[model samples]
Target chain A: MLSEFDLIAQYFTRPPRANGQVALGVGDDCALLTPTAGMQLAISSDMLVSGRHFFADVDPYTLGHKSLAVNLSDLAAMGARPLGFTLALALPEARAEWLAPFAKGLLALADLHHCELIGGDTTKGPLNICITIFGETAPGQALRRDAAKIGDDIWVSGTLGDARLALAGYRLNACKNDPDEPLGGQINLDASNHALAAARMHQPTPRVALGLALRGIAHAAIDISDGLIGDLGHILQRSGVGAKLSVDDLPLGAVLAQQPQTIQRHFALAGGDDYELCFTAAAAQREAVLTAAQNASTKVTRIGSIVADPGIAFVAADGTALDLQLSSFDHFRTT
Target chain B: MLSEFDLIAQYFTRPPRANGQVALGVGDDCALLTPTAGMQLAISSDMLVSGRHFFADVDPYTLGHKSLAVNLSDLAAMGARPLGFTLALALPEARAEWLAPFAKGLLALADLHHCELIGGDTTKGPLNICITIFGETAPGQALRRDAAKIGDDIWVSGTLGDARLALAGYRLNACKNDPDEPLGGQINLDASNHALAAARMHQPTPRVALGLALRGIAHAAIDISDGLIGDLGHILQRSGVGAKLSVDDLPLGAVLAQQPQTIQRHFALAGGDDYELCFTAAAAQREAVLTAAQNASTKVTRIGSIVADPGIAFVAADGTALDLQLSSFDHFRTT
Candidate 1:
């Protein structure tokens, strides 16, 4: 059996890439990093367990990508430029077949963003991956959740509900037509839609460039990890404000739109793991906000407006308030 | 049952202390840290799991101290000053009783070192704790394992083998002697020795001050986590040199000194979790090294010297080379 050190040396310890931020990478007690002058370091941590975060048989490569991607999303929400990350992994055993692809997926994204793997620990235990990411941002430039102000327009990047649809398809096995379910009214996804949703679920893009572009334009920001409404609620709570979200304007991918209207609304409002940035910007910056989205090569939809009230209100297309009981996934909450 | 968010807010979240290094701490998507200009960031991660790293019934307070202590030790080895840390904790349940003392112990040490708890994730899973620590060092001033030179004196900070002795005593139940094996001689620790060993095992100081002091005086340094000989071997291998260790000169605590000679040697050479700094310096710098240690208020013992040869030699008091099979703990080793 390969030892933890051997595994790390063989797979994780690559020659340091020419990232000036990383002064020292791996092979030492600690890695040394040099943040740019006048830049504040943005750091975040995320942990993923086998059963809780993903299926036991989930693709190792996708698991690797999602693990780092989730942590990167936190940085993205903060409008920070990725610098380096450390992975603390606990594995049941040292299996080369599983590790090779996992490293590939992890490093591919790291390379894409110019983020280096600085240092981490490997141990033998239940399969769990914890990543702590470091990034850099100019002082007072981060999109903070407590910075939202009255009359700011709430915006969301990309489309939501696709990942949730992908999950629902997997859970209900609805990718295939089931004649017996004609009366059961289960939603079925076509192969093309299925592929789109699955990709959205498995390999999320962290919208890093979009966040960087929104650094100065957005008043407050948060990533849509625990659905749009719940996450936006966090911003509102922190800012001591509220929001009025337009249900009809909520961005929905074509695949998610084909579902029942109620399902579409539910998934878009409450399903988690979208990994898209939700931010609020002053109405006067509308032109600049659109330019920022274009510069980052991402789409942004104006979904709501911040208000002085203390709770969220959902407005339907008919101008009637939509009352929906919704809650995000709480780890300790009993089903 | 407390939700993960509630648990974090109740137990882990605290007001940002007046550490100017932390720009933004807990309650954000990412913690913002400000590293000193012209200083490099030193980062390290360590994970501890129940049943594997500690006893199932280990005190949450000690476990908390140890979980963060081990990671800080890595920074200490690099001669970095503690800045802040992120704790990713996966707990089986959110029990207030267990969390209270755990947080108390963790924050007490953090306060001592001025290391703020920046940000991290709390999840429901098998009990595990992963801490990623951040520190700062002057550019190129880190004490590295690859910097040892030939003929440099090897020095170790503080005493060794006491933690291992405590472990053995606990494993062997030495406090309650068994009369059935009269011929089986096992060293018994008195109350004072037991207290010393237990304290060493439960709450290991990271030697951060000593490491910071050794930056210019020492050529190479490492924390003796996996015993002296094995960890020193890392320095030798990395520095392209060997060492000649005089076992008679090794600093032993009072408890370890009372053990049989063989047991004392074995514990000193192969035991793990000592968390003491082992460093090398030029022979001419011995007085400076002693002064550095004195400035840090830590004891330093010169035990060996770097040699031109490629293998370590252990010599007895009579100058005879000793042949003993010693190996450090390998997590994946089946035996």
Candidate 2:
């Protein structure tokens, strides 16, 4: 196995990291780049620490992919194009065999998105990975959640809650023999869409191109890493408006279609890690978006509509309404 | 405490990030910035975990400043202007008291350098901090270690070995009640120079201004974080050149000059955390650099010259060469 130095030279260091937008990269005391004309940089960051974000025994390759994926999802939500990213890695100890596949996964995503690895530092400690991703967009063209308003049609791409089901399955599988909530090795799915949702749960794809397409077309947008209802609340709150979502209108996949009603409705509204775009558009722009979705072969279901009221409300199948009191995962939460 | 949503709004969501270079910034799903015209972006990153880079009991304010200072030093070494930075902070638990002060120190340094806080993420874990700093310079203008040429004069800013001295005192301070090594709480300095050295150790300043001044003048540059001998070795290895140093020319601060010859030489030649600029310039620029140094009110001492032999040689007071085999601290070294 190569030492950390050899591993860095072989995999991490590239010949003067070249992305089309950079002035200088990789082989310098610092990489340098000039901003392109008529563009703004979009940025976001995420830190994934051992045990907090992933299991210690999880595949390093998967961890690498997921780490970048979550950050890319942020860029997609902002309607920006990936430029490049810097990774800061902390390891308890250097493990050459583990690093190779991990680097492969990280670079693979970088290649797919055309995001070059400009710079990074490696040190020691409990494994921690923090990645800061940069993206570009035309000035004032990036989508934000603050513009959703009354009379706007609310929409979401892909399905919601598949990721949650998959997560449950993963946890259940790990503790199959445990006395508590004893579901065996098989992932316990509530029949809404076991197969598809599980896959969605594990490797949620960021709707990058869709976000770009909706930059001007959509009134406002957010990436649903959190559940749809909660993520949409951001738009409503920022826009000083309200929303009414119908559980019946959701695009629950095959599993939910086959599930019991209670489970299907709950998962459809409250499940997280969709990594899909939840957006709004003026009633007038609806046709254009629908047409665009047809051409792009992606779904943009009008799950609800904006309201003059200033909060979120879920409409039942029979027209009953309930205010959700749940919150998504809070890593830094004190309670 | 407020939910994760409020925490982001209150602390994480910074000023509508208007990096003129970035097309977009925080609060959006992603961040965007255009590289400056004809310039490439220089990038670097580092992470400091609790119990790794510092003691847990150290002041958060100091920790924050040091966290940023270390990353900024990377940019300073490249002679790149400070642009912006992102911080990913992982905590075992949220403490408002800890966070507010930490942000204060981090923000103070960022403002001092005109570097904006572009983006970052937060999570719960064993306190870890990953900082990525982005800066830029015109294409081909960044200083690099590999460009040193034979006959180039080697220069370093400030003095060295003070940080180690400070560390020594800090350790002894922890063991005041013990008589181990026949030492106590009070330092056995030649005078109070050790106190000055200790401060230099604790808060070594990065030489950004001096470095920017040397742009287009210095042939190669690197920041002196590691000891001179070891760090200079990096320049030599990358440039495939050698260096001959006059030990008498080593910049021993007044604090160490009155000490025993061994301690003085060791501290002067082998001290780390100096955060000074160690650069090589063509002989023709010597006068210009000295002039610039005078204007900046900072010292620029030329200790050696790059040679064709491709290794480092130290000429002692007796005119005999000594090979210093000590390597400075490696963050990843296990032993």
Candidate 3:
């Protein structure tokens, strides 16, 4: 096995050749950068550990993409431009093949989104990955959750619930083995749906451009890590407002549409892992938002309205009000 | 018995309030800060994990402080002023008492040093902590490792090897229990003479003021996590220069001076965990560095000079080259 130093060198330190504002990169005491004048720096950090955040047998490449992508979603919520990020990873041992593909997946997104790989640390331990992203936005202009006001239109991008269905092997197409296991059903099912959902769940788009595109335009924003209802409740509580949504208008995917009613509603309301932008905008600017989103090649679907009442209430298709309570994701609630 | 939410609200959320730059802190989707215009952003990140960088039973308080302090030292090395930081902590289970004192220590240092805990994530996993610190400096004027040139004077702050000597438990004090074993010595001693070493080992101060004081004045700088010779070599490689050190000029703490000659040399050359600043400056600015050190209530000792050559060589009191090679902590190399 390659030692830690060799693994770090082979995977991390080649040269700086990415986008966003990367003034100084890796191989130094600390990363350095200059956020443009009139811009405020937006920063967020997250750590993913072995057997906790991912299965021990998971692919390193997917892990790398997920780690960085999650932090980028934080920037998206703040309506800040994606600038660069630092990664600190821990591992039990060094495996060259794993390191090579992992670094490729990591840098590939970095290049795709014009984000610079600034500074990071690699150490020996159980596989733990911590990434911090640095982004910028015009001063006093970044979208804030606390600024959400009553009577605003609540909207979300992309579809919900597919990532949840993927957990059932719907995205993976075929079950790998263990025929008797319930989650292992449909052993011969097509793999494309399962594969697509797996990709979305593991490495969903961060909505960076859509977020920056909403700057000054959207009053409040957040990325949905928890299920739609649960995550939206956060913005409502912090902003001292309430929201009412229609289940009929939810932007769910094809897999979910094909599912029975009960499962579809369950996924739509309680399933998580869709990293789409959920934001609120003024009623007057609704047309402008639709136009801007269209121009950016992203979808914007209005599902409800922020209200004066102080709780999240879901209005079912038949007009019955469902009693709902917010719950945290696994480990987030128990950690 | 407390769960993750209780752990965060009780420990991490309580902290020193930030000043002008930070508009909000903790308990948000993202922390918001507005840096003054005309200032460049300086950033650095680090990660520490239980059973890897630290033992699981190590004092959580000191671990918290040291995690932030090391990155702060990086800011100091660049002559950047402290702004705020994001913390990502992962734990297998939430322990309230452990987190409380840990947050206390971390906030105490942050308050004294004028930094703030902005935002981060708390997740379930083995104990892992990652902190990313942001700082501000004049545009295009941050200190860098590659700026040193031949004939520049090499200097270091505080003493050179107290941290390393303490690790060996030569004559220090009683030590704490190993974090992982509760019985096994994390660095192998009863915290004995090594107590001071271990304490210094655990919480080395970042030289923030010294860095800002040297801004636009010093040629190069770096924080010494990897020990003197090894870290200084980083400067040599980047600057395309060499250095000659006078062993006799190395500053040994009064305790370390009492040790045998061989032990003293070992501490001076190869010991690690001394978070002091090692930097290079023009020979003409030597006096200014001395004056600045006095104002900062620290000593800046000049032990040698950068040379036209491209590697490090030790010069003895007799003015002759030492035959033995000089190297300090290389993380991957087994001692």
Give the per-residue lDDT digits (tens) of candidate 1, residues B1-335. 23554556568887888888888888779999998988999999988877767777878899889888988899999999999999998877778889999999999899988999998988778888899999999998999989999999999999988887777666556435445222125676667778888788888888999999988889999998878887898899889999999999988866898888877887787777789999999999989999999999999999999999998899998999999777666211111
Query: Residue A3 of candidate 3: its Cα lDDT?
Result: 42
Q: Pick by lDDT: which candidate is best?
A: 1
The TM-scores, chain A only, for the candidates as listed are 0.93, 0.87, 0.89
lDDT tens readout by residue for model 2, B160-199: 6666556555556667554431323334563366578656
TM-scores computed on chain B for all candidates = 0.93, 0.87, 0.88
* Runs of candidate 2 exceeding 4 Å displacement: A1-9, A14-19, A173-187, A190-198, A253-258, A294-297, A322-325, A330-335, B4-25, B32-36, B172-195, B317-319, B330-335
Return the TM-score for candidate 2, rounded to 2 decimals: 0.89
In the range A1-335, model 1's lDDT, one tens digit per residue, is: 33464565468778888877788888789999988999999999988887777777889899889988998899999999999999888888888888988998999999898999998888778888999999999998998989999999999999998887877766557334444222125576777888888898889999999999998899999998878887898899999999999999999976899888877888888777889999999999999999999999999999989999889999998889989866655211111
RMSD of 3: 4.4
Query: Over the stretch A52-144, how does candidate 3's per-residue lDDT look in tens digits?
Result: 556677677887787788888888889888888888887777788788888888888887877888888777777888888878877778888
User: Backbone clashes in each candidate structure, one number apiece?
Assistant: 0, 45, 16
The predicted structure with the larger DockQ, 2 or 3, is: 2
Docking outcome class, model 1: medium
Which whole-number lDDT from 0 to 100 does residue B295 have in model 3?
A: 76
